[model samples]
Target: MDMLHFGGLAVLLALCAMASNMIYNHFYEMVEHHYGWQRTVRMRVVHTLGFEAFFMAIALPLTAWWLSISVVEALLLDVTFSIFFMIYAFCFNWVFDIARHRLAARVVADR
Candidate 1:
């Protein structure tokens, strides 16, 4: 495929991912609140796995259609991406949480 077409598909996929992520996060927060679950490492792992699984379900068909590939091919590609993103998400959130806590503590100490 040409670069133009590939770029368009990439944008479309990104938009879809953003929408799905919003929906998934809303629901995940609800579940956490209901269960009074803390954002521990195990919870982060679960969150990443759930998001990846949910995203793969939504992206599989779109990817296959965009690339003119078989569903199996799309699954393989999505799985590869999912693995990378899972690690990234885990680390990003972990660091973000630490930073947020530190900032909050500083604010409280200033008062």
Candidate 2:
């Protein structure tokens, strides 16, 4: 594919990622609230696994169809991406939670 095609694909993936993040967080937070589950290590691990699994389910088939690759190949690629995203999601969520807490604190302090 050309650079333009790759660029478009990247944009689509990014949009999908954003949408998934929003949807995942909504439901995840609901569960946390219902269960009173804190963001402990166990909850983080569950979050990472659930998020990646949800993403892979949507992405793997799209990737195979888009790239004209076999299911096995797509699964392999998805696994590779999953490994990266696992660490990335863990760190990203950790940092985001910290930043959000700080912002909320500032807002409350200013009130």
Best by lDDT: 1
Per-model C-alpha lDDT, please? 0.87, 0.84
TM-score for candidate 2, residues paired by index: 0.84
lDDT of 1 by residue, 2-111 (tens): 99988987898889878988999899999999999998989988998898888878888998999999889988877777788789878987898799999999999999
Off by over 4 Å in 1: none
- Candidate 1: global Cα-lDDT? 0.87
**Clashing pairs counted in every model:** 0, 0
lDDT of 2 by residue, 10-90 (tens): 687778878988899899999999999998778888999999888777777777787788868989867777798899999
